[model samples]
Target: MEFTVKNVEETMAIAYKLGKFANSGDIICLNGDLGTGKTHFVKGLAKGLEIKEHITSPTFNIVNEYDGRIKLYHFDVYRVNDPDEIEAIGFDEYIFGEGVTVIEWSNYIKELIPKEHISVEIIKIPNKNLNYRKIILNYFGEKYNYIKEIFI
Candidate 1:
């Protein structure tokens, strides 16, 4: 579904809705340009999971773990130059682990992602005072088909 976010609050609301349906073993691929509020959406996800800690972009750290109602593995692959770099960090353990995983700049390691992952794409519109964004949702497996009912 397409979302016209007027500000960060709206974006977080969308993330909160999505978070309610997030489950273990779920992989979310976030695609967008820099300063597109990717991290803001992630903060909403953490809140939905009942996480109390602060959530930030995992740029230099690469990954950040949060303990919430369920485990959350946040990844930022913008600086990663090779797919092998993902493996070096043992991303599989988290991608396939017992928690929800959200990957920023996931397009960088597209080949490493599972086929059944959920894809969320955000686009910024130029010349708009409001932080306009187009959010696209694509489900790759039967497990996520129900998500369409909620957002689409």
Candidate 2:
């Protein structure tokens, strides 16, 4: 589905709603340019998971784990030069683990991403407000078919 938001609050609100449906083994792949609020979307997801800690991009660390109603494994792979680099950090374990995983700049590690996962692409609207964003969500497997309920 496609959604447009005028500001950060709206962006996070949509993500927050989707986050409410997060379940164990769920993987969300995020694609967007720099400063497109990908990390902010994660913050909203964290809130939906009832996580109280502050959320930030793990650009240098590679991954950040947060405890919530369910565990959250957030990853930033923008700096990764090779897929093997991510694999070296036990990428399989976290993706297969008992938690929800969100990957920013996921396109960089596209080959490693599971076939069944949710993909979110955020686009900045050109010639309009800087905060405007067009978010497109695609589900890759039957498990995420129920996400239609969020838009309906």
Poorest stretch of ten by lDDT in candidate 2:
124-133
For each candidate, the alpha-carbon lDDT, in order, equals 0.89, 0.93
Model 2, range 50-139, lDDT digits (tens) per residue? 899999999999999999999999999999999999999999999999999999999998989989999999999986546789999999
lDDT of 1 by residue, 1-152 (tens): 67888788888999988887788888999999998889999998888888899999999999999998889999999999999999998999999999999999999999999999889888888765666877777889998987888786
Q: Candidate 1: what lDDT?
A: 0.89
Off by over 4 Å in 2: 128-130
Using TM-score, give the best candidate's number.
2
> Evaluated with lDDT, which candidate comes out highest?
2
TM for every model, in the order presented, reads 0.96, 0.97
